[model samples]
Target: MPITGTTRVFLIAGDPVAQVRAPEIYNHLFERHGIDAVLVPVKVPPARLADFVRNAFGAENVGGMWVTIPHKAAMMALMDRCDPVAQLAGAVNAVRRADDGAIEGALFDGIGFVKGLDHFGIPLEGRRVLVIGAGGGGQAVAAALALRGVGELAIYNRSTDRAADLCARLAAASGGVTKVAASPDPAGYDLIVNCTSQGLKQDDPLPFDPKRVDAGAAVEDIIMTREPTPLLKACAELGISAHAGFEMLVQQIPEYLRFFGMPELARTLQDDTSEVRALLYPK
Candidate 1:
C-alpha cells in the first residue's frame, strides 16, 4: 500500500509501538479492500499523548486511532464520546472520529477475548475467573467477564491500589457477580487470564505460577511474542488448555473496522482467519 496525497490515515499509538500487530492486519485490510487508507504505528509517549489526541488525531487525513497499553486508560479523557463498553471497562482500545468531529471511544479487548474463550469451549457464564495485571487490557477483560454473568471475578495487580480500584469498579457494574481483589490464587478459578506484557520478553517472570492453577482450569495470556509465551507454555506443560493472545486481537478487528466507519468490512473477516492469523503471528 503506497501513500498518496489523498490517503486517509489511522494510527495505533503506544509507548513501545514496535511489537504491535494492528498496523499489519489493518493495512492488509485496507489494501485488499482498495480503501485509500493506512493504519500506521506511532510511538506516542505518555507526556505527548494528550497533545496528539487534541491536534494530530483531528487532522483531515486522520480517520481514527487505536489505543494500546498505557494510553488506553488515558484516552478516555480525550474522546468526545465514550461508548458504554469503554465506560464500564474504564479504558478504550479503539477510537474513531465521527463526521461531526466527535471522537467516540470503544473497547474490543474483552469482546474478542471472551469470544475466543467461547470458541475454545471455555465458557464464561457462571464461572469464577481471575485476571492478572489490572491494567487497560485487564480491566476490559474483567468487565467483559462480569457482564457475561460470570460467577465470580478477582483481580491482581502489582499496585494494590489499582487492583482494589478496579475490583470496586467491576463490582459496582457487575450486578450479582462476586468481585474480589486478591493475590493470584488459581485455586477455584475456571479461567485465569494474564493481561499484562510480561510474556513479551523472554526474561519476563510469569504473572503467576501455572502449577498454582488447578488442573481443571484454563489459562490465557494477552501477549503475542515471537513464540508461545512462557506462561502459556507452562500451562501447556501442565496439560491445561492455553489460549493464544492473537485470539483476542483478531476477534476485535471487526469491532474496530465498524468503529472506523467500515461496518461491512467486519463480514469479510467473520469466518476465515487462518490466513490473517498466519500473517499476524508468522511462525
Candidate 2:
C-alpha cells in the first residue's frame, strides 16, 4: 500500500531528550511493520512545555506524545481529563488528542512495570513487595503492584511524608485493601523495586544495603546500562532473581503504540522484538 498524508507522527518530550532511546525503539518497529508512523524525541525545556504541547495538537499529523522526566507532573494540568491511573499516580507519561479535540492523559509506568513482570512469569499476587522511592515512578509501581493483589507494600523514601501521601492515595484507589507500610528492611519482602534515578550514575550507592535484601526476593531496577546497577549486581551476587530496565521499556512500547490508535503498529513492533534488542543493545 502506498503511504499518504495519513502518516502518523509521535513525539517524546523531556528536558534530557537526547538520552532517550524511544526513537530508536519505535522507529525500528515502525519500519518492520511498514507503518508510515514516526516517533521522535523533542527537547522541550521546563518553561516551554505548555506552549510546545499546545502547538503540537494543532498539527493534524501528530497522533500523540510521550511525556517524560520533569514534565510528567507538570503536564497534567494541560490535559482535558486524566485517566484514573494517571490521576492516581499524579503524573502523565502518555497523551492523546481525542476526536473532540480534548487532550487525555495517562500514566503507563505502572502498567508497563507489571506487564514486564508478567512477561517473565513473575507473580505479584499475594507477594510482599518493597518499593524504594515515592516519586512518579515509585507511585506508579505501588499502584500497579496493588492492582496485582500484593499481600503488602512497604514504601520508603527520603521523605516519609511523601511516602505516606503516596501510600494513602494508592490505598484509596485499591479499595483500602492494599496494606501500606514504611520500612527499609529488604529481608521482609518477596519483591524489591528500585524506581529512583540513583543507578543512572556510576557513583550512586545501592538503594539499600545488599546484606538486607532477602535472598528469595526478585529484584528490579528501572535503570538501563551496559553493566548491571549496583543494586542489581548485589542481587545477582546473592543469587536472587533480577531484571534490568530494558525489559520494562520493551514491555511498555506496545501499550504506547496502542494509546496512539495504532494497535497494528504495536503488534508489528512486538513481533520484531529481536530486531529491537539488536538495535538497543548492539553487540
Model 1 lDDT per residue over 132-250, tens place: 88877888888788788888888888888887787777776677564555677678788989988898987889888888887688998988665899898888888988987778877
Cα displacement (Å) at residue 22, model 2? 1.8
TM-scores of the candidates are: 0.88, 0.91
Predicted model with the maximum TM-score: 2
Clashes of 1: 0
lDDT of 2 by residue, 1-283 (tens): 2335787889999998878878877777677677788888999999999999989999988999999888999999889998887888888999989999999998888888998898778888778888888888888878777677787877888888888888888886665654444566678888888888888877898887667877667888977777888878777777888898787677677788888887876776576666656777888
Candidate 1 pairs with clashing backbones: none
* Predicted structure 2: lDDT: 0.82
Which ranges of candidate 1 are over 4 A from the true structure? 16-19, 201-205
lDDT of each: 0.82, 0.82
TM-score of 2: 0.91
